[model samples]
Target: MMTALLLFWPALAALLVLLVKGQGAKRVAFIAALVEFAIALFAATTFVVAKTAPQFELSVPWVERAGISFSIGMDGISLLMVLLTTFLVPLIVLSSFKHDYKKPNAFYALILFMQTGLIGVFVAQDAFLFYFFWEVALIPVYFISAIWGGARRVAVTFKFFVYTIFGSFFMLAAFIYLYFQTPATGIAPHSSDINAFYQLALDTNTQSWIFWFLFLAFAIKMPVFPFHTWQPDTYTEAPAQATMLLSGIMLKMGIYGVLRWLLPVVPSGASQWLDVVLVLSIIGIIYASVIAIRQRDLKRLIAYSSIAHVGLISAGIFSLTEQGLQGGVIQMLSHGINVVGLFFIIDIIFSRTKTREILSLGGITQTTPALSICFMILMLGSVALPLTNGFVGEFLLLSGVFQYNYVFGAVAGITIILGAVYMLRMFQGVMFGTRSPETEVFADLTFNEKAVLIPLVIMVFWIGLFPSTFLDISEPAVFNLLNIIQKR
Candidate 1:
């Protein structure tokens, strides 16, 4: 029952958002998100990582004939992922209070609706339910970007929608194929149970098809390198809140898909294509990093940096090693926290200065010391400075990749240097350069803005200083997954 609420409560809150008038929608939605986060924390205390199979599992027969169940559960991985979703949603809602967008009810409602889909994706144990929520999560972002986005929102959002839908088509087709291939029992004609699907013994040839079909969807969503063309434009045009959803949490969907669905379900194919995928991921790291260095548009720079960061995460996951998987898990939380902070800072800057061009503004630090300090902390985390949040994950991830192959690890590790170069450079341009006329009178962070940023700053060092706290929660799940891959 509690597990079900984690999924449905946000949905209920979204409905409430629709009915509530004016600013009440934001308050009610924010409270709902807070309550939801509290429930997730409770579940965390209750979850037992030693038991590898899902806990807090709630399964109800949904399509009896097809052997589908309304099954949702949490293991260590599911728990952490769901926790990340709930933890960030309230913050996302809180971050947006400053903007009184048109029809505020609809805007807040869409955010809560998106929260529902995100939470649903993490807990779902049945493939059909997972797929349903995957698309469910996509719908709100489309509307959020399309309706509330900047000038080219319509066009950029259209392209974004088309690309993702194209990927989802392949994903759906792959699932349909898997549904038929799913082993059936006297209890049902076919099974869409995720665990049952894992028991199938398919030839490497067939696994190859499944790998690519699934990869097409996951890759596009991660917007991995070549598939990532839609991202910068989308991020640039979309409102900061929507971009926060996209980078901060939504993109994790693809990484989660790769870890949960692609790797275990088809180990043979994963091993076979591991080299190819790793190469592509490595290329994306350098490719995106190079582009980020050249970008003058602050939003575009972060967008590209996001791609590079995810590229490294992708390489770690495909490494299929213990360190890689664990690092990926650790990085997921860190990336979400840091990226949200960065985007929020950018949003504040744009709101104040009316420009996102790094070259257009200077000496922000002179006036907005608090904001500058916050930016410095987040930027350091982004660049993975020692004893910072980014370092722990990147260190573990690189180590994992190194164990997989020295050459691959070495090339992928380039981001450590490149990320610092560009990030510090961007910081220098925006915060510390000579105070220009435009930035001379900049205001420091307001109370609401501090409320949004303080938590992020705390998290940066919390994870940086005591990463083991986060890692301990995810380690068991990561090992459980590696065990599945190895035993297969």
Candidate 2:
């Protein structure tokens, strides 16, 4: 329950700040996000110190008959995700300070509310509670993009909502089916606990249907391949800070769902459909990579790249091996940090120059050396350079795929080379070559900007260089998931 407060405190802080006015409102929001970040850090530290296992912990039952409870707990996997969410929120809030926003208090308040939803999604141990949090998280982001996004905000925001809901309904249906199937419901209806879900044995036919239903929802959220049409518009239209949250933390909600709900609850179904998932993921990676190479807008290019990266993650998960799951989890974290860093640089450039068109931009390194250097490192990481965070995850993932099938591994391996082509081309065009007149007077990184990015840059290198430390934390949980899948 105390862990739950880590989610609520931010909203509570936001309410307090609403009473203040103007710039102070922004400061209050930044402070509130900082406070929440601290609490998350505390929770992470405490969980590790206590040497906790997943506990059926909650303060009280929220809706007893529905099996809905205010339950929340963490395995190593969930805790890492919770930490990532909290870690990024404050940085996002602080980064927004430089922009002149309308109704600063509300903007900050919404961000806090968003945090509550995100944490709720990660920690939720109950299916009904999880779905409730899923919708809750979506709402705040809708407002964030609608109120704070760029020129086409309305259409982009609406598409974002509709696109997610279109997929989410499938998830909702699957859960409803499972809820009724629970023998406790027949004995005398009970709640919908996710942990309880792990124990039930569904017929293969049912598992097959439920698996697709659940996967559809998660895949739409991940926006893999054919389903990814909505991403570019939304990412390009949303404000940079909003984009960071979307790409960095929000997208992980999809991966988390696959881990928390899809894998454990429907292993038989997942195994049956593994090849189908692997095919879609590979297509998305290659398809998006090719498209990204031709992109004119920087944000759009990155958006496509995000789709590709998550595609690989999806493929890794479907591999269904211990190594695959571990790679997927580590890759999720690494992608979150590295992609967010890339987008932050995108935000920095857009904030100063007011355009995302790659053709319109030129050699920024001439003036923004530090910014260029940072972007280059992040780009290299994106391309999975040997010492960067990306390499370790890709290496593990491809290894896992190879174990599954050599053809699968070889096809997935092509992304490593293609990724470099698009990323370096984008990098060389924007950061290196001759300066465009439009960027001629560009200023270097500000103290505030550096403050936001330095930590992310450190993470890129740290994870790249010392992956074992991070991978070790996730091993136990990953092993648990693999065992569940194998048993099924």
| Maximum-lDDT candidate | 1
lDDT of 1 by residue, 219-242 (tens): 999868788999999999999999
- lDDT, candidate 1, residue 35? 98
lDDT of each: 0.91, 0.84
Q: List the residue pairs that clash in candidate 1.
A: none
lDDT of 2 by residue, 25-66 (tens): 888888777877787677666565234356325645776656
- Error (Å) of candidate 2 at residue 466 is 1.7
> Which ten contiguous residues of candidate 1 have the minimum total lDDT?
178-187
Off by over 4 Å in 1: none
lDDT, residue 293, candidate 1:
97
C-alpha TM-scores of all predictions: 0.99, 0.96
